[model samples]
Target: MARADHWSDTEIALTVADYMKMFTLELAGQRYNKSAHRRALLKLLNGRSDAAVELKHQNISAVLRDLNCFWIPGYKPRSNYQEALATYVEDWINSHSDFDRVSQAAVKQPAFVPTGVEFSTLLVETPKPSTTIQEEHPPYSPNRAASKRDYVAQEARNSALGSAGELLILEYEEYRLRSAGERTLANRIEHVAQSKGDGLGYDILSFETSGQERFIEVKTTAFAKETPFYASRNEVSFSADFQDQFHIYRLFEFRKSPKLFSLAGAISDHCQMDPVNFICRLR
Candidate 1:
């Protein structure tokens, strides 16, 4: 029998979207430091009487005014926040969401365009292993939650990175190498491992610029700005035993914000990992 906690990809996406939209309408500015964005949305929703640009006025005041008091969960609202409200009214929609509605809503929402400000910047993380942890950890559970669509989407993001994301990662690698006085450029690297090895193909295997050899396995994630990826047992062992030539690079928040970190040397010498869910997620 399936567990109650299990969620389909569509279910997760829709739920997340519902939270996101409500988050936007009620407290996006309060929850996130989206100052300029908050102001822009207000302007868009509220038309002013200006001589130069003539525009028709759309009164969303009633809807916006009512939703203003709604609060987003999991965040403390800013004390003196200048909040923005939602446009249009949906009698049926509430705080919950379903995938079909979210897909349609996403099309109408203007794309998130970053301003020149640091808050609006796109960030990326290369990959790394870290030791510091701050809070109580949750009981480990295998992701039997990901539906086929979700699995395919997340897997695609982790691998290949759709050329554009790959290009950004390479660019960061080149810049870092140059800074370290290392000249092996990123473009020269290639994936030589056969797909579906004993299990999954090696993340990446390549030679260094100085005729040195490197066997690198990459794990890219966008979990949280501060969280390290959950390393699998196989990953820990592979890097540890093959320390002489192996490397694990972790890239986090590759799209909105990016950070890179790596672990080298015999894995056991540098890190330790738990067994429960580690081996199952090996890829």
Candidate 2:
């Protein structure tokens, strides 16, 4: 097996296309064989071993992550990818306007929750602490404007998907409590944002097994796990005041099968808190 320092334009394009195919299938809830895809991809790249092809796939995942786009979860994005790969991905995304259109279409349809169905047990990863201090205010797109566009277009404008995601969480919380024989607690679960209002700073009011209250703020997107989300000053301050009870449930790939990761305590402790907008007073 010969190793190349960099992938050719054709090779990168092929890998990106293959990845998109897998992504679309996965989003549609269709099953696919990763090994079979690798074997098939090998035939397209001359003298590239199974391992090399797999690494390239991981590289593609890294590029996607950098662009704030979703990568295949199985790939586990590896970094130090070729710069050209980023360009290739940007081009692919720019060409595919239908990608966003399709995702938006899915969002418009109501979220499907079957009656008497057991929601999948949620497995959440703890937010890792940052090693270095981040900039006070970082530009939305320091380099790749295309990537920035992808992030903003999907996350900000997709309101239906966001509402559906909150509904999913609300049901999950209620179902979880009921399953534990805490029917009273389940009954008490409140959709604060809907029933009360969005000014409450959190969406759902849930409870712990021991009957402790939980303040949950859900952020949902159809994009990948690494995509950035907007948080209001009110939400941040509320999290700070109620650090023990506040939680941010980030739902990624919401249009597909939604999976969540949680950040507890103050929001600033978990994320690089940057102020994107501010109110100005003209006296």
Candidate 3:
């Protein structure tokens, strides 16, 4: 199989379309087989091998991550994707209003105790910084768009979904502790956001298997895995103060079947932590 240095426009478009279809199915809680999709894609691509198509799918994943949109979970995002690919993905998103509509549609809450569950851990990867900064589009700019679908804004506004996600995590924490024979520690688990207030930098208070206290800050979204989240100055400061024990349980795809990935230690080490807002007052 010969490796092409660059993908043609038609190939990129076809790949993006296939990737989005899989992503939509995953979000809708519909089952899909990646190999089947790839085999189907091979027909459109001109003699492209399965591995080549797989890499292209990963490139599509990277582009979606840049756009702050969801990508198929099976293809882990890989960086250094072509700029043209990003443009094609952005165009597809802008043209398809239904994508945003379906993504934002209300989802039924998942069962309290999820049965037949398989957990896969996602380690947050450092997003490859764009070399060429494209002009800002109103809503869907890869960097910062003013659009309503802007993940950062959407996440801030969806309080009901956020709270629901936190409750799910609380259940998981208690279940985890009890399963490990830490029944007393499980009982001590507190939903600090409810008990004390949101002033505390963290949300739930659980413990390590060693019985050491773990300060957990839960950031959840009903959208994709790479959706951006807001963290306050207080939260950042608290994480720095308690780096050893601080953990961020990032819950995504919450409205349907919820899944999570965790970030531990100092926030600075894991996230870019850009300052998106400011507090100003009359002096």
- Which stretches in model 2 have alpha-carbon errors above 4 Å? 1-4, 24-33, 96-100, 103-110, 114-117, 124-148, 151-156, 179-181, 222-227, 253-256, 273-283
Candidate 1 stretches with Cα past 4 Å from truth are 1-95, 98-167, 174-188, 193-202, 206-211, 228-234, 266-283
| TM, every model | 0.41, 0.76, 0.77
For candidate 1, write residues 23-65 as lDDT tens digits: 4443222235334433433354323222101111111222221
Residue 205 alpha-carbon offset, candidate 1, angstroms: 3.7
C-alpha lDDT score of every prediction, in listed order: 0.38, 0.73, 0.73
Ten-residue segment with the worst summed lDDT in candidate 3? 137-146
RMSD of each: 14.6, 4.3, 5.2
Order the candidate numbers by TM-score, best to worst. 3, 2, 1
**Residue pairs in clash, model 3:** 139-147
